[model samples]
Target: MPLLCHNGRFADTLDPVLAGDNPSFKWGEGLFETMRMAAGEIPLMHLHWARLQQGLTRLGMNDAALQRSVLENILRELALRNECAAAGRLRLHLYREGAGLGFVAEAAPLAAADHGWNERGWSIEVFADARIAPDAYSSLKRANYLPYLLAARRAADTGVDECFLLNAQGNVCDAARGNVFVVRGGIVQTPPLSEGAIDGVLRRHLMSLLAAAGRPVQELGLTMEDLLEAEELFITNAVKGIRWVARFRQRTYAHAVCKELYGLLGQPFNNALVAP
Candidate 1:
Protein backbone atom coordinates (compact mmCIF):
# COMPACT_ATOMS: atom_id res chain seq x y z
CA MET A 1 0.00 0.00 0.00
CA PRO A 2 1.13 3.55 -0.62
CA LEU A 3 2.33 5.25 2.51
CA LEU A 4 0.59 8.21 4.04
CA CYS A 5 2.27 11.31 5.41
CA HIS A 6 0.31 13.82 7.42
CA ASN A 7 1.48 17.26 8.39
CA GLY A 8 5.24 16.55 8.48
CA ARG A 9 5.55 12.96 9.71
CA PHE A 10 4.84 9.57 8.25
CA ALA A 11 1.52 8.17 9.37
CA ASP A 12 -0.43 4.96 8.97
CA THR A 13 -3.25 6.84 7.35
CA LEU A 14 -4.62 10.33 6.76
CA ASP A 15 -5.37 12.02 10.04
CA PRO A 16 -8.12 9.91 11.49
CA VAL A 17 -8.36 12.47 14.26
CA LEU A 18 -9.44 15.15 11.79
CA ALA A 19 -13.06 15.63 12.75
CA GLY A 20 -15.72 15.67 10.09
CA ASP A 21 -15.70 19.42 10.57
CA ASN A 22 -12.35 19.70 8.76
CA PRO A 23 -12.72 22.41 6.16
CA SER A 24 -11.23 20.31 3.39
CA PHE A 25 -13.67 17.50 3.96
CA LYS A 26 -16.60 19.75 4.73
CA TRP A 27 -16.25 22.68 2.34
CA GLY A 28 -13.31 21.81 0.05
CA GLU A 29 -11.33 24.71 1.44
CA GLY A 30 -7.82 23.88 0.18
CA LEU A 31 -5.32 23.85 -2.69
CA PHE A 32 -3.33 20.98 -4.15
CA GLU A 33 -0.50 20.19 -6.54
CA THR A 34 -0.30 16.94 -8.53
CA MET A 35 3.36 16.62 -9.41
CA ARG A 36 5.43 14.31 -11.64
CA MET A 37 8.29 12.43 -10.05
CA ALA A 38 11.02 10.74 -12.06
CA ALA A 39 13.95 8.94 -10.56
CA GLY A 40 13.05 10.46 -7.25
CA GLU A 41 13.10 13.99 -8.63
CA ILE A 42 10.62 16.50 -10.00
CA PRO A 43 11.84 18.15 -13.18
CA LEU A 44 9.18 20.82 -13.39
CA MET A 45 9.33 21.50 -9.65
CA HIS A 46 9.91 25.21 -10.04
CA LEU A 47 6.74 25.60 -12.06
CA HIS A 48 4.72 23.44 -9.72
CA TRP A 49 5.98 25.28 -6.64
CA ALA A 50 5.29 28.65 -8.24
CA ARG A 51 1.74 27.64 -9.03
CA LEU A 52 1.22 26.28 -5.51
CA GLN A 53 2.69 29.41 -4.00
CA GLN A 54 0.25 31.51 -5.96
CA GLY A 55 -2.65 29.48 -4.64
CA LEU A 56 -1.29 29.51 -1.10
CA THR A 57 -0.92 33.28 -1.27
CA ARG A 58 -4.53 33.58 -2.35
CA LEU A 59 -5.55 31.32 0.53
CA GLY A 60 -3.68 33.54 2.99
CA MET A 61 -1.02 30.94 3.78
CA ASN A 62 2.55 32.01 4.49
CA ASP A 63 4.48 29.02 5.78
CA ALA A 64 7.14 29.24 3.13
CA ALA A 65 9.70 27.26 5.07
CA LEU A 66 7.25 24.44 5.80
CA GLN A 67 6.22 24.37 2.15
CA ARG A 68 9.81 24.21 0.96
CA SER A 69 10.69 21.49 3.48
CA VAL A 70 7.77 19.33 2.39
CA LEU A 71 8.58 19.78 -1.27
CA GLU A 72 12.26 18.93 -0.81
CA ASN A 73 12.13 16.19 1.81
CA ILE A 74 8.64 14.74 2.25
CA LEU A 75 8.11 14.22 -1.49
CA ARG A 76 11.16 11.98 -1.73
CA GLU A 77 10.19 10.10 1.42
CA LEU A 78 6.68 9.42 0.15
CA ALA A 79 8.04 8.11 -3.15
CA LEU A 80 10.44 5.76 -1.40
CA ARG A 81 7.74 4.57 0.99
CA ASN A 82 5.48 3.74 -1.93
CA GLU A 83 8.33 2.09 -3.85
CA CYS A 84 7.77 4.46 -6.75
CA ALA A 85 10.93 6.51 -6.37
CA ALA A 86 12.19 5.69 -9.85
CA ALA A 87 8.94 6.66 -11.58
CA GLY A 88 5.78 7.83 -9.92
CA ARG A 89 3.36 10.73 -9.42
CA LEU A 90 2.92 12.77 -6.24
CA ARG A 91 0.14 15.06 -5.07
CA LEU A 92 0.66 17.58 -2.30
CA HIS A 93 -2.60 18.74 -0.77
CA LEU A 94 -2.83 21.80 1.46
CA TYR A 95 -5.84 22.18 3.69
CA ARG A 96 -6.61 24.36 6.66
CA GLU A 97 -5.42 22.68 9.83
CA GLY A 98 -6.55 23.16 13.43
CA ALA A 99 -9.65 25.16 12.56
CA GLY A 100 -12.91 24.46 14.33
CA LEU A 101 -16.33 24.45 12.68
CA GLY A 102 -15.56 26.88 9.87
CA PHE A 103 -12.77 27.17 7.26
CA VAL A 104 -9.15 27.64 8.35
CA ALA A 105 -5.95 28.52 6.46
CA GLU A 106 -3.03 26.10 6.56
CA ALA A 107 -1.17 23.70 4.29
CA ALA A 108 -1.53 19.92 4.47
CA PRO A 109 -0.43 16.81 2.53
CA LEU A 110 -2.35 14.34 0.40
CA ALA A 111 -1.23 11.36 -1.68
CA ALA A 112 -1.76 11.31 -5.46
CA ALA A 113 -1.27 10.65 -10.59
CA ASP A 114 -0.82 8.52 -13.60
CA HIS A 115 2.52 6.92 -14.42
CA GLY A 116 3.75 7.02 -18.08
CA TRP A 117 0.12 6.84 -19.40
CA ASN A 118 0.76 8.07 -22.92
CA GLU A 119 1.05 5.31 -25.45
CA ARG A 120 -0.56 5.45 -28.91
CA GLY A 121 -3.00 8.35 -28.32
CA TRP A 122 -6.20 9.25 -26.52
CA SER A 123 -9.85 9.51 -27.52
CA ILE A 124 -11.85 12.48 -26.25
CA GLU A 125 -15.31 14.06 -26.30
CA VAL A 126 -16.89 17.23 -24.92
CA PHE A 127 -18.73 17.29 -21.59
CA ALA A 128 -21.86 19.43 -21.80
CA ASP A 129 -23.73 18.92 -18.58
CA ALA A 130 -21.85 21.66 -16.65
CA ARG A 131 -19.43 24.50 -17.33
CA ILE A 132 -16.41 25.74 -15.36
CA ALA A 133 -16.86 29.25 -14.00
CA PRO A 134 -14.36 31.93 -14.91
CA ASP A 135 -12.96 32.82 -11.51
CA ALA A 136 -9.69 33.01 -9.58
CA TYR A 137 -10.22 29.50 -8.15
CA SER A 138 -10.59 28.10 -11.65
CA SER A 139 -6.91 28.78 -12.25
CA LEU A 140 -5.78 27.16 -9.02
CA LYS A 141 -5.81 23.44 -8.18
CA ARG A 142 -8.27 23.98 -5.39
CA ALA A 143 -10.44 21.40 -3.64
CA ASN A 144 -13.75 22.16 -5.35
CA TYR A 145 -13.33 19.45 -8.01
CA LEU A 146 -16.82 18.12 -8.70
CA PRO A 147 -16.92 19.40 -12.29
CA TYR A 148 -13.66 17.72 -13.17
CA LEU A 149 -14.82 14.54 -11.45
CA LEU A 150 -18.03 14.53 -13.44
CA ALA A 151 -16.21 15.19 -16.70
CA ALA A 152 -13.86 12.31 -15.97
CA ARG A 153 -16.82 10.07 -15.22
CA ARG A 154 -18.39 11.04 -18.53
CA ALA A 155 -15.18 10.21 -20.34
CA ALA A 156 -15.16 6.82 -18.65
CA ASP A 157 -18.81 6.18 -19.48
CA THR A 158 -18.14 7.08 -23.13
CA GLY A 159 -15.02 4.90 -23.25
CA VAL A 160 -12.81 7.88 -23.98
CA ASP A 161 -9.68 8.91 -22.13
CA GLU A 162 -10.53 12.57 -21.60
CA CYS A 163 -13.33 15.11 -21.99
CA PHE A 164 -13.14 18.83 -22.75
CA LEU A 165 -14.99 21.16 -20.38
CA LEU A 166 -16.58 24.44 -21.44
CA ASN A 167 -16.40 27.71 -19.58
CA ALA A 168 -19.45 29.52 -18.22
CA GLN A 169 -19.68 31.45 -21.49
CA GLY A 170 -19.64 28.21 -23.52
CA ASN A 171 -16.03 28.40 -24.66
CA VAL A 172 -13.79 25.33 -24.57
CA CYS A 173 -11.80 25.92 -21.40
CA ASP A 174 -9.84 22.85 -20.40
CA ALA A 175 -9.85 19.08 -20.34
CA ALA A 176 -11.01 16.95 -17.43
CA ARG A 177 -7.55 16.86 -15.87
CA GLY A 178 -5.29 19.15 -17.83
CA ASN A 179 -4.94 22.05 -20.26
CA VAL A 180 -6.22 21.80 -23.84
CA PHE A 181 -4.28 22.79 -26.94
CA VAL A 182 -5.34 22.79 -30.57
CA VAL A 183 -3.02 22.98 -33.57
CA ARG A 184 -4.48 24.68 -36.60
CA GLY A 185 -2.60 25.63 -39.76
CA GLY A 186 0.72 25.02 -38.00
CA ILE A 187 -0.10 27.39 -35.14
CA VAL A 188 -0.98 26.12 -31.67
CA GLN A 189 -3.60 27.82 -29.54
CA THR A 190 -5.01 27.35 -26.05
CA PRO A 191 -7.64 29.23 -24.08
CA PRO A 192 -6.29 32.01 -21.92
CA LEU A 193 -6.70 31.99 -18.12
CA SER A 194 -9.43 34.60 -18.57
CA GLU A 195 -11.41 31.85 -20.28
CA GLY A 196 -10.96 29.68 -17.14
CA ALA A 197 -8.04 27.35 -17.88
CA ILE A 198 -5.85 26.22 -15.00
CA ASP A 199 -2.26 27.38 -14.89
CA GLY A 200 -0.84 23.87 -15.43
CA VAL A 201 2.79 23.06 -14.77
CA LEU A 202 3.23 21.34 -18.10
CA ARG A 203 1.26 24.09 -19.81
CA ARG A 204 3.67 26.75 -18.58
CA HIS A 205 6.71 24.65 -19.48
CA LEU A 206 5.43 23.98 -22.99
CA MET A 207 4.45 27.62 -23.56
CA SER A 208 7.83 28.87 -22.36
CA LEU A 209 9.64 26.29 -24.44
CA LEU A 210 7.75 27.33 -27.55
CA ALA A 211 8.38 31.00 -26.82
CA ALA A 212 12.11 30.37 -26.43
CA ALA A 213 12.16 28.58 -29.78
CA GLY A 214 10.52 31.62 -31.45
CA ARG A 215 7.40 29.63 -32.51
CA PRO A 216 5.32 30.72 -29.57
CA VAL A 217 1.86 29.29 -29.08
CA GLN A 218 -1.10 31.61 -28.71
CA GLU A 219 -3.39 31.96 -25.69
CA LEU A 220 -6.85 33.21 -26.59
CA GLY A 221 -10.49 32.37 -26.58
CA LEU A 222 -11.44 29.04 -28.15
CA THR A 223 -14.62 27.11 -28.89
CA MET A 224 -15.79 23.57 -29.59
CA GLU A 225 -15.60 24.49 -33.26
CA ASP A 226 -11.95 25.39 -32.81
CA LEU A 227 -11.23 21.91 -31.45
CA LEU A 228 -13.44 20.18 -34.06
CA GLU A 229 -11.62 21.93 -36.93
CA ALA A 230 -8.10 21.63 -35.57
CA GLU A 231 -5.46 19.57 -37.31
CA GLU A 232 -4.06 18.30 -34.01
CA LEU A 233 -5.05 18.28 -30.36
CA PHE A 234 -3.42 17.32 -27.07
CA ILE A 235 -3.79 17.69 -23.29
CA THR A 236 -0.99 18.26 -20.82
CA ASN A 237 -0.61 17.60 -17.07
CA ALA A 238 2.26 17.39 -14.63
CA VAL A 239 2.02 13.60 -14.48
CA LYS A 240 0.99 12.67 -18.02
CA GLY A 241 3.15 15.34 -19.63
CA ILE A 242 1.52 15.29 -23.07
CA ARG A 243 -0.89 12.97 -24.85
CA TRP A 244 -2.18 13.52 -28.36
CA VAL A 245 -5.84 12.99 -29.12
CA ALA A 246 -6.37 10.39 -31.82
CA ARG A 247 -10.09 10.91 -32.10
CA PHE A 248 -12.52 13.58 -30.94
CA ARG A 249 -16.05 12.88 -32.06
CA GLN A 250 -15.84 12.02 -35.81
CA ARG A 251 -12.62 13.93 -36.39
CA THR A 252 -9.29 12.17 -36.02
CA TYR A 253 -6.09 14.15 -35.35
CA ALA A 254 -2.41 13.71 -36.05
CA HIS A 255 0.33 13.91 -33.43
CA ALA A 256 3.13 15.57 -35.34
CA VAL A 257 3.03 18.74 -33.25
CA CYS A 258 2.29 16.94 -30.00
CA LYS A 259 5.10 14.48 -30.54
CA GLU A 260 7.45 17.29 -31.50
CA LEU A 261 6.54 19.23 -28.37
CA TYR A 262 6.88 16.15 -26.16
CA GLY A 263 10.36 15.61 -27.49
CA LEU A 264 11.15 19.26 -26.95
CA LEU A 265 10.22 18.82 -23.30
CA GLY A 266 12.93 16.12 -22.98
CA GLN A 267 10.45 13.20 -22.91
CA PRO A 268 9.71 13.40 -19.18
CA PHE A 269 7.83 10.11 -18.74
CA ASN A 270 9.06 6.66 -19.68
CA ASN A 271 6.25 4.21 -18.91
CA ALA A 272 8.46 1.24 -19.66
CA LEU A 273 10.55 2.21 -16.66
CA VAL A 274 7.65 2.23 -14.22
CA ALA A 275 7.36 -0.78 -11.95
CA PRO A 276 4.24 -2.83 -12.27
Candidate 2:
Protein backbone atom coordinates (compact mmCIF):
# COMPACT_ATOMS: atom_id res chain seq x y z
CA MET A 1 0.00 0.00 0.00
CA PRO A 2 1.16 3.55 -0.66
CA LEU A 3 1.93 5.64 2.40
CA LEU A 4 1.06 9.28 2.91
CA CYS A 5 2.86 11.71 5.15
CA HIS A 6 0.45 13.74 7.23
CA ASN A 7 1.86 16.33 9.59
CA GLY A 8 5.18 14.49 9.37
CA ARG A 9 3.63 11.15 10.33
CA PHE A 10 2.98 8.14 8.11
CA ALA A 11 -0.50 6.74 7.46
CA ASP A 12 -1.43 3.90 5.18
CA THR A 13 -5.07 4.90 5.09
CA LEU A 14 -6.82 8.27 4.90
CA ASP A 15 -9.68 7.27 7.24
CA PRO A 16 -8.10 8.99 10.24
CA VAL A 17 -6.05 11.50 8.32
CA LEU A 18 -8.73 14.18 8.11
CA ALA A 19 -11.80 14.99 10.18
CA GLY A 20 -15.26 15.04 8.69
CA ASP A 21 -15.51 18.74 9.36
CA ASN A 22 -12.15 19.56 7.88
CA PRO A 23 -12.46 22.90 6.09
CA SER A 24 -10.40 21.72 3.17
CA PHE A 25 -12.72 18.79 2.55
CA LYS A 26 -16.01 20.54 3.34
CA TRP A 27 -15.31 23.98 1.95
CA GLY A 28 -12.19 23.62 -0.18
CA GLU A 29 -10.28 25.95 2.14
CA GLY A 30 -6.68 24.98 1.42
CA LEU A 31 -3.72 25.26 -0.95
CA PHE A 32 -1.57 22.69 -2.71
CA GLU A 33 1.48 22.32 -4.93
CA THR A 34 2.14 19.55 -7.47
CA MET A 35 5.84 19.05 -8.17
CA ARG A 36 8.08 16.91 -10.32
CA MET A 37 10.83 14.83 -8.74
CA ALA A 38 14.01 13.94 -10.63
CA ALA A 39 16.99 11.91 -9.41
CA GLY A 40 15.53 11.74 -5.91
CA GLU A 41 15.10 15.52 -5.80
CA ILE A 42 12.90 18.29 -7.11
CA PRO A 43 14.75 20.34 -9.76
CA LEU A 44 12.32 23.29 -9.74
CA MET A 45 11.74 23.22 -6.01
CA HIS A 46 12.91 26.77 -5.48
CA LEU A 47 10.10 28.10 -7.62
CA HIS A 48 7.53 25.74 -6.09
CA TRP A 49 8.57 26.73 -2.58
CA ALA A 50 8.40 30.39 -3.46
CA ARG A 51 4.88 29.95 -4.80
CA LEU A 52 3.79 27.97 -1.74
CA GLN A 53 5.06 30.69 0.56
CA GLN A 54 3.27 33.30 -1.48
CA GLY A 55 0.04 31.31 -1.24
CA LEU A 56 0.41 30.91 2.48
CA THR A 57 1.02 34.59 2.89
CA ARG A 58 -1.93 35.43 0.68
CA LEU A 59 -4.24 33.10 2.60
CA GLY A 60 -2.86 34.10 6.00
CA MET A 61 -2.17 30.43 6.76
CA ASN A 62 1.36 30.83 8.03
CA ASP A 63 2.49 28.11 10.40
CA ALA A 64 5.88 27.53 12.00
CA ALA A 65 5.85 23.84 11.00
CA LEU A 66 5.42 24.69 7.33
CA GLN A 67 9.08 25.59 6.86
CA ARG A 68 10.81 24.70 3.61
CA SER A 69 13.30 22.27 5.20
CA VAL A 70 10.61 20.40 7.11
CA LEU A 71 8.31 19.95 4.10
CA GLU A 72 11.22 18.90 1.90
CA ASN A 73 12.19 16.19 4.36
CA ILE A 74 8.60 14.97 4.55
CA LEU A 75 8.32 14.78 0.77
CA ARG A 76 11.63 12.93 0.44
CA GLU A 77 10.57 10.39 3.04
CA LEU A 78 7.21 9.90 1.36
CA ALA A 79 8.90 9.37 -1.99
CA LEU A 80 11.22 6.80 -0.44
CA ARG A 81 8.33 5.03 1.28
CA ASN A 82 6.48 4.86 -2.04
CA GLU A 83 9.60 3.59 -3.87
CA CYS A 84 9.62 6.63 -6.16
CA ALA A 85 12.67 8.43 -4.85
CA ALA A 86 14.42 8.53 -8.18
CA ALA A 87 11.69 9.93 -10.42
CA GLY A 88 8.12 10.81 -9.44
CA ARG A 89 5.43 13.39 -8.94
CA LEU A 90 4.92 14.90 -5.50
CA ARG A 91 2.00 16.78 -4.06
CA LEU A 92 1.98 18.89 -0.89
CA HIS A 93 -1.39 19.97 0.44
CA LEU A 94 -1.92 22.54 3.19
CA TYR A 95 -5.24 22.91 4.96
CA ARG A 96 -6.66 24.81 7.88
CA GLU A 97 -5.89 23.20 11.22
CA GLY A 98 -7.38 24.71 14.37
CA ALA A 99 -7.15 28.27 13.13
CA GLY A 100 -3.55 27.60 11.98
CA LEU A 101 -2.63 25.03 9.29
CA GLY A 102 -1.45 21.46 8.71
CA PHE A 103 -0.11 19.54 5.72
CA VAL A 104 -0.17 16.20 3.85
CA ALA A 105 2.54 15.14 1.41
CA GLU A 106 2.43 12.29 -1.09
CA ALA A 107 4.50 10.96 -3.98
CA ALA A 108 3.92 8.70 -6.99
CA PRO A 109 6.53 7.06 -9.24
CA LEU A 110 7.00 7.94 -12.88
CA ALA A 111 8.64 5.86 -15.62
CA ALA A 112 11.05 8.74 -16.27
CA ALA A 113 11.50 12.46 -15.78
CA ASP A 114 9.93 13.12 -19.15
CA HIS A 115 7.07 10.69 -18.63
CA GLY A 116 4.05 12.60 -19.94
CA TRP A 117 5.19 14.89 -22.76
CA ASN A 118 2.67 14.15 -25.53
CA GLU A 119 5.02 14.18 -28.53
CA ARG A 120 2.19 14.15 -31.09
CA GLY A 121 0.68 17.22 -29.39
CA TRP A 122 -2.77 17.63 -27.77
CA SER A 123 -6.17 18.35 -29.28
CA ILE A 124 -8.08 21.04 -27.38
CA GLU A 125 -10.98 23.44 -27.60
CA VAL A 126 -12.35 26.51 -25.88
CA PHE A 127 -14.76 25.97 -22.99
CA ALA A 128 -17.48 28.62 -23.24
CA ASP A 129 -19.67 27.65 -20.29
CA ALA A 130 -17.74 29.71 -17.72
CA ARG A 131 -15.29 32.58 -17.51
CA ILE A 132 -12.42 32.79 -15.06
CA ALA A 133 -12.31 36.08 -13.22
CA PRO A 134 -8.98 37.68 -12.32
CA ASP A 135 -8.65 38.07 -8.60
CA ALA A 136 -6.14 37.99 -5.75
CA TYR A 137 -6.84 34.27 -5.40
CA SER A 138 -7.10 33.32 -9.05
CA SER A 139 -3.40 32.58 -9.51
CA LEU A 140 -2.98 30.46 -6.37
CA LYS A 141 -3.32 26.68 -6.69
CA ARG A 142 -5.97 26.39 -4.04
CA ALA A 143 -8.34 23.54 -3.27
CA ASN A 144 -11.36 25.46 -4.53
CA TYR A 145 -10.79 24.12 -8.03
CA LEU A 146 -14.34 23.82 -9.29
CA PRO A 147 -13.70 25.75 -12.48
CA TYR A 148 -10.79 23.64 -13.63
CA LEU A 149 -12.62 20.52 -12.52
CA LEU A 150 -15.61 21.39 -14.65
CA ALA A 151 -13.33 22.25 -17.55
CA ALA A 152 -11.61 18.90 -17.28
CA ARG A 153 -14.97 17.14 -17.31
CA ARG A 154 -15.94 19.13 -20.34
CA ALA A 155 -12.77 18.05 -22.09
CA ALA A 156 -13.60 14.43 -21.34
CA ASP A 157 -17.20 14.81 -22.48
CA THR A 158 -16.13 16.48 -25.69
CA GLY A 159 -13.37 14.00 -26.43
CA VAL A 160 -10.69 16.67 -26.32
CA ASP A 161 -7.39 16.45 -24.55
CA GLU A 162 -7.82 19.86 -22.87
CA CYS A 163 -9.91 22.99 -22.86
CA PHE A 164 -8.90 26.62 -22.89
CA LEU A 165 -10.61 28.85 -20.32
CA LEU A 166 -11.20 32.50 -20.98
CA ASN A 167 -11.16 35.32 -18.49
CA ALA A 168 -14.16 37.50 -17.72
CA GLN A 169 -13.09 39.77 -20.56
CA GLY A 170 -13.45 36.87 -22.99
CA ASN A 171 -9.66 36.54 -23.49
CA VAL A 172 -7.62 33.39 -23.18
CA CYS A 173 -6.64 33.04 -19.54
CA ASP A 174 -5.25 29.51 -19.32
CA ALA A 175 -5.89 25.85 -20.01
CA ALA A 176 -7.79 23.42 -17.81
CA ARG A 177 -4.67 21.86 -16.31
CA GLY A 178 -1.80 24.15 -17.30
CA ASN A 179 -0.69 27.53 -18.54
CA VAL A 180 -1.31 28.41 -22.20
CA PHE A 181 1.21 29.91 -24.60
CA VAL A 182 1.13 30.84 -28.25
CA VAL A 183 3.78 31.43 -30.87
CA ARG A 184 2.82 34.14 -33.34
CA GLY A 185 4.95 35.96 -35.84
CA GLY A 186 7.99 34.24 -34.26
CA ILE A 187 7.18 35.85 -30.89
CA VAL A 188 5.91 33.77 -28.00
CA GLN A 189 3.10 35.22 -25.90
CA THR A 190 0.93 34.13 -22.99
CA PRO A 191 -1.76 35.62 -20.86
CA PRO A 192 -0.44 37.67 -17.98
CA LEU A 193 -1.35 36.89 -14.36
CA SER A 194 -3.50 40.01 -14.48
CA GLU A 195 -5.62 38.12 -16.97
CA GLY A 196 -6.31 35.30 -14.47
CA ALA A 197 -3.71 32.74 -15.60
CA ILE A 198 -2.42 30.49 -12.87
CA ASP A 199 1.06 31.44 -11.70
CA GLY A 200 2.55 28.15 -12.92
CA VAL A 201 6.09 27.25 -11.85
CA LEU A 202 6.96 25.82 -15.27
CA ARG A 203 5.48 28.85 -16.99
CA ARG A 204 7.71 31.17 -14.99
CA HIS A 205 10.79 28.97 -15.48
CA LEU A 206 10.14 28.58 -19.20
CA MET A 207 9.92 32.35 -19.57
CA SER A 208 13.30 32.66 -17.86
CA LEU A 209 14.79 29.90 -19.99
CA LEU A 210 13.50 31.54 -23.15
CA ALA A 211 14.85 34.95 -22.13
CA ALA A 212 18.19 33.39 -21.34
CA ALA A 213 18.23 31.82 -24.80
CA GLY A 214 17.39 35.13 -26.49
CA ARG A 215 13.75 34.07 -27.02
CA PRO A 216 11.91 36.13 -24.45
CA VAL A 217 8.16 35.48 -24.09
CA GLN A 218 5.77 38.39 -24.00
CA GLU A 219 3.22 38.42 -21.18
CA LEU A 220 0.31 39.61 -23.23
CA GLY A 221 -3.38 38.77 -23.12
CA LEU A 222 -4.38 36.35 -25.89
CA THR A 223 -7.74 35.91 -27.58
CA MET A 224 -9.25 33.15 -29.71
CA GLU A 225 -8.55 35.26 -32.73
CA ASP A 226 -4.92 35.60 -31.69
CA LEU A 227 -4.71 31.84 -31.16
CA LEU A 228 -6.17 31.18 -34.60
CA GLU A 229 -3.52 33.39 -36.16
CA ALA A 230 -0.64 31.91 -34.13
CA GLU A 231 2.05 29.68 -35.55
CA GLU A 232 1.94 27.25 -32.62
CA LEU A 233 0.31 26.62 -29.24
CA PHE A 234 1.53 24.82 -26.16
CA ILE A 235 0.56 24.26 -22.53
CA THR A 236 2.90 23.88 -19.58
CA ASN A 237 2.94 22.53 -16.05
CA ALA A 238 5.71 21.53 -13.65
CA VAL A 239 5.20 17.80 -14.02
CA LYS A 240 4.54 17.49 -17.78
CA GLY A 241 6.86 20.30 -18.90
CA ILE A 242 5.39 21.22 -22.32
CA ARG A 243 2.54 19.79 -24.43
CA TRP A 244 2.04 21.18 -27.88
CA VAL A 245 -1.48 21.81 -29.15
CA ALA A 246 -2.16 20.20 -32.52
CA ARG A 247 -5.65 21.52 -33.18
CA PHE A 248 -7.75 24.28 -31.65
CA ARG A 249 -10.99 24.78 -33.59
CA GLN A 250 -10.10 24.76 -37.29
CA ARG A 251 -6.50 25.86 -36.65
CA THR A 252 -3.49 23.56 -36.64
CA TYR A 253 -0.16 24.37 -34.95
CA ALA A 254 3.49 23.49 -35.52
CA HIS A 255 5.80 21.98 -32.92
CA ALA A 256 9.30 23.08 -33.93
CA VAL A 257 9.42 25.75 -31.20
CA CYS A 258 7.71 23.45 -28.72
CA LYS A 259 10.37 20.80 -29.35
CA GLU A 260 13.15 23.33 -28.87
CA LEU A 261 11.60 24.64 -25.67
CA TYR A 262 11.18 21.11 -24.32
CA GLY A 263 14.88 20.56 -24.92
CA LEU A 264 15.65 23.76 -23.03
CA LEU A 265 13.50 22.54 -20.11
CA GLY A 266 15.47 19.28 -19.90
CA GLN A 267 18.85 20.98 -19.53
CA PRO A 268 20.13 22.11 -16.12
CA PHE A 269 20.20 25.81 -15.39
CA ASN A 270 20.69 28.24 -12.50
CA ASN A 271 18.43 27.70 -9.44
CA ALA A 272 17.08 24.50 -11.02
CA LEU A 273 18.64 22.59 -8.18
CA VAL A 274 17.60 19.59 -6.13
CA ALA A 275 15.48 20.43 -3.11
CA PRO A 276 17.58 20.94 0.02
The Cα local distance difference test for each model comes to 0.77, 0.85
- At residue 264, what lDDT does model 2 achieve? 76
Candidate 1, residues 122-215, lDDT tens digits: the string is: 9999898999899867898888788899999999998999999998889999999899999999998999998999989889988998999999
Worst ten in a row by lDDT for model 2: 267-276
Residue 224, candidate 2: Cα error in Å is: 0.7
lDDT of 2 by residue, 1-276 (tens): 899888888988454788889889999989999997766788789999899888888888865547788788888888988988877889888998986788888898753434645756799998878899999999999999888989999999999999999999999999998999999888889999999999999999999988998888999989889999999999998887788999988888898888778777763221132443
What's the TM-score of every candidate structure? 0.89, 0.92
What's the residue-level lDDT of 264 in candidate 1? Answer: 80
